[model samples]
Target: MPPEPVAGPAADIDSLFQRGYDRLYADDSTGAVRAFAAAVCLEPGHGEAWAALAEANGGGAAAVQAYAHAVVVDPGGWMWRVGLAEALRLAGSLNDAIAAYRELSGERADSAIVRLGHARALSVAGRPAEALAEYREAVALRPDDAEAALELAEALTGSGDALAAVELLQPLSRRAPDDAGLHHAVGRAWIALREPEKALTALRRARDLDAEDRLGAAPLIAALEAGEGADLSAAYVRALFDRYADRFDQDLLGKLGYAAPELLRAAVDRVIGPATGLRVFDLGCGTGLAGIGFRPLAGFLAGVDLSPRMVEKARERALYDDLRVGDVVAALEEVPESWNLLVAADVLVYLGDLAPVFAASAKALVPGGRFAATVERSAEEGFTLGPTRRYAHAEAYVRATAEAAGLTIRLMEHCTPRREKGVGVPGLLFVAERPADRPQIA
Candidate 1:
């Protein structure tokens, strides 16, 4: 039985805590959060109340902090520490989560949960080798644990061992015939194996079983069915960049040999000459890489990106006068004729329909202002989403789009934006100017 609310200030911490539990079980997370928050406010040192608050928040940064507080208040509580680590993982602090799990593993080497958590964090942080080792350890610790085995199989599939993944998943899928996640994993493995029919069957079954589509089987199913490319979802793009935010600079510059920013900078200079204090807007700025090169040319610089983590990284550079996390098109549409120069470096790959972006760019730029960008080159008639899930645009399409947007193309040249699989990716760098004499589109 739950405690009834007491009148006014007479409400005791116990009653509030009980009420929080009641609300939580009733699926009223917001109300539960308020109740637990009040309990903590009344008794700040209550570790259970703090932990309850953390759970109600569903593992955001506030949950991480709440769990940390609970761990500090109740150092002997093993589950509190685990909650803290899991909260960190869910909050996208992958490195911190890895460290927390590592410390926990040092104390309890035999815990399968800790090992699984560590493996997941490592996988997200792009350390596949370490993640594989951790997954193996977890499965070895608990051979009968279906979830752990499934994770290991997924990791194998991701690491390009689709055959091994299929072998491991076959028995598991047979045993748990109705398990959506298992079916989804099998679908992905089949996709990697180039068996589209098998992939579609598994994915459709997974999708039907999981009506909410929590396993993300719908997108895979759609891609396989269509046999053509579409614009990647905003959520998908945001999550990808957020996961890579920590290692973006190192991986892009050192591993991928990315040079879109430099390429765009040179082209902008050639088209507009030396910077004379222009108001620059960096579309999809991405950790301020383009902003850094354009800063010398700008009296004021503003930037926007889709990923909050990526925006945070860009903010740390302190180059932009204004930085926002939002869709590039929405950001440009917010204020028209506001910028003297707009730059997009390696940004268009995620977008298939460039019409909105080009129109927005034209509207955002002042009269005679320059817009510079890079696009992966496609020999096809229009644009195509490639195997890498990035869009590539044909040269003719770029010219047609710019002209339709009332911008005059000053330069469009072949260049290498980045390297993938040890080969330079073909790209086009273009500078288009919004002509002063042309009537502005309302």
Candidate 2:
């Protein structure tokens, strides 16, 4: 039940389409659709009216059909096809968008914007390698475009071409020398390349850029200063909690099934045996995930993280009696035996070696206080620091390190706490007690 195309004067049809296009431009969708429909009625073969109607309808199947009709009437209309591709993308019809973009490639062979859109659409369609090439092509065409360069870098990173991404982003970093996010991207890319020195330099730049912002460049700045041989960057550790600070509960709890905080709380309860009025510190509190679990048990709760973002998020929850933004170990060092319990959940994974943090925690703890932590489990020999630079420690390694730092491993449990890349990597949930007297064990 569709109206047939009416063939009329070209000027009349063009005027009708113009009216509809005007309505669309004014954000009057209902009036635009009516005007476009009327224009199509005036001249059934008018490509512009049909294309206008298609776009006005938000690129649904009916809209697509209208665009097809327009293309059939005027096959040389490249702009109409480009609009059709955008409409298709909006409709989530990626395959149709790809087809339209491919058709566009024939008409406008070297349009950078066209290529960039096509690349983004292709990436959304899960063709990352092809998308990467398209992004690279777009960047080559528009060398001065920061967005093109960033997209190319993102595509390369998504495709596991990190070294190539580094090569691209490093130069872009210079161009956008004051963009903290850009420096963060460059630093991450350098880390992927296993170039820590380069990573350090870039991350420091990020911190300096971030310093202008109120949250400050604490993450990048501290990491640059403290992250060195056998220690994780302060910024990197800060970033973990900061990135997840906002939507940690909904994302990690809902999607990833993260339960480390609660599990650690239960482990602490079992070991400590219902101790009352204990002063607790949640190191790397990270949006108060650990605080929520430990709050009931503690006489008072203090939270600390390197990221001010995470600190702000934690503050919103009002779980911590007090929250501080600083490096975990440094914060712990200043506490002066104020805490009877210190809980670090999945925080050590960001640290390659635990001796310094452990020593700091031991120093922070009151006599006979306990340190509860969750660590990523690796093989007996221990896992090497990967491109992410997060270390997965072996059971023996943790035990040895704990004992070396004058802490006694009271309990160790092997549990499948979380799934990574669909592989169930073992996790170590342990309660290590700092002795009343400093006792060094081998």
Candidate 3:
């Protein structure tokens, strides 16, 4: 009798799935993608594996395909459907995402999350009228939902009705005075109405309610005094980003829809001409979002950040010729002033004072070297710490600061850096050059 064929050990699917998630949670997308692909191959109907695979891919064609399969394998699963819809949304398939959400609503019409998503999809798709209606409906269903009110109020404001945004929240305020977003919205609306006193009052309440200061304590101070500003310390920012590194790209690119990096790259090409063979320095280069955006233009790319975790993520991209975790100001101080371009996409928002960064930046660049950055636009005459614990700078302040630092503005224009509360956050992107003839400052 022929020797019995050796039996192969069974596939340890649970172990494989767990390992896939471990890699994903640690931000090892490539490893996680491989593990998840193996899990799915072992069991095609593994809805969770499919979903994990979708997340690993970060919402592209691969994610769309994975999520679609997940929903197919588990038609009755809520997360599967939600994941598919969200994946579709982030993939820029607005119509398909909306249709999927609508179909889900037909089956489970009471899901606030689904309706909220539907409203957002509609808003981004430029069907604001329909979006407004759905937002109103979502708010009605969950009157105390801060996120719902935020989106609804933002939508109202976008429609040129700040008063309505205020009015919509006024009743909610009495019902939930402890709601941070409620008071924050009221403060924003009051400012729009030009009622300084009322704005200060509501902003104070918002700060008090936000014990963790997620709404930021700096903005509260700004309302009380012209020069009052908030500083989001390096430690706070580093800690915040360390925890965020794993999902940074997804949250910023897919959901919040950050595009400042691309905007800065465009300004570089338009203002500096060909960027090829130029030395590029990326300040606060979190996850290399800005690094990859400008890599094609660089002969050499280098980056620095306060968050080591962010630096690590940036390193994985292989876009930078050098990446270091250090104080941005100090790093710039150490580097020789030979860079052709420096860009900080959404980095200065954590800093209340622009003078020092600008001064350091001015000294770090070669003659005619460019510094490109973005800041939240302030309506007043100076910089301010805002409700989001991020700093905003006035155009006047930015221009004066640039001149004082020996840099001349090449371009300064209004741009949408990202979406906050489902609305475009107003910002300014500028490319300023070190005067070729200016003597180096001691």
Give the top-scoring candidate (lDDT): 1
The alpha-carbon deviation from the true structure for residue 295 of candidate 1, after best TM-score superposition, in angstroms, is 0.6
lDDT of 1 by residue, 1-442 (tens): 1122233565688888888899999999888988888888778888888898899889778899999999998898888899999999999999999999999999999999999999999999999989999998999899768899888988876655666677778787888899888899888877776557778988999999999999899899888888732346565566568768999999999999999999999898888787768999998888889988999998999999988889999999999999999999999999999999999999998888898898998999999998999999999989987888799999999999888888899999999999998899999999998999996555
Candidate 1 global Cα RMSD? 12.9
True-structure RMSD for candidate 2: 16.1
All candidates: TM-score: 0.57, 0.52, 0.50
The per-residue C-alpha lDDT of model 1 at residue 289 equals 92
TM-score of 2: 0.52
Pairs of residues clashing in candidate 1 = none
- Give candidate 1's TM-score: 0.57
Ranking by TM-score: 1, 2, 3
Candidate 2: count the clashes. 2
What range of 10 consecutive residues in model 3 has the weakest lDDT sum? Answer: 1-10
Error of 3 at 133 (Å): 52
Alpha-carbon lDDT of model 1: 0.87
lDDT of 3: 0.83
Kindly report which residue pairs in candidate 3 clash with one another.
215-387
Report the alpha-carbon TM-score of model 3 versus the true structure.
0.50
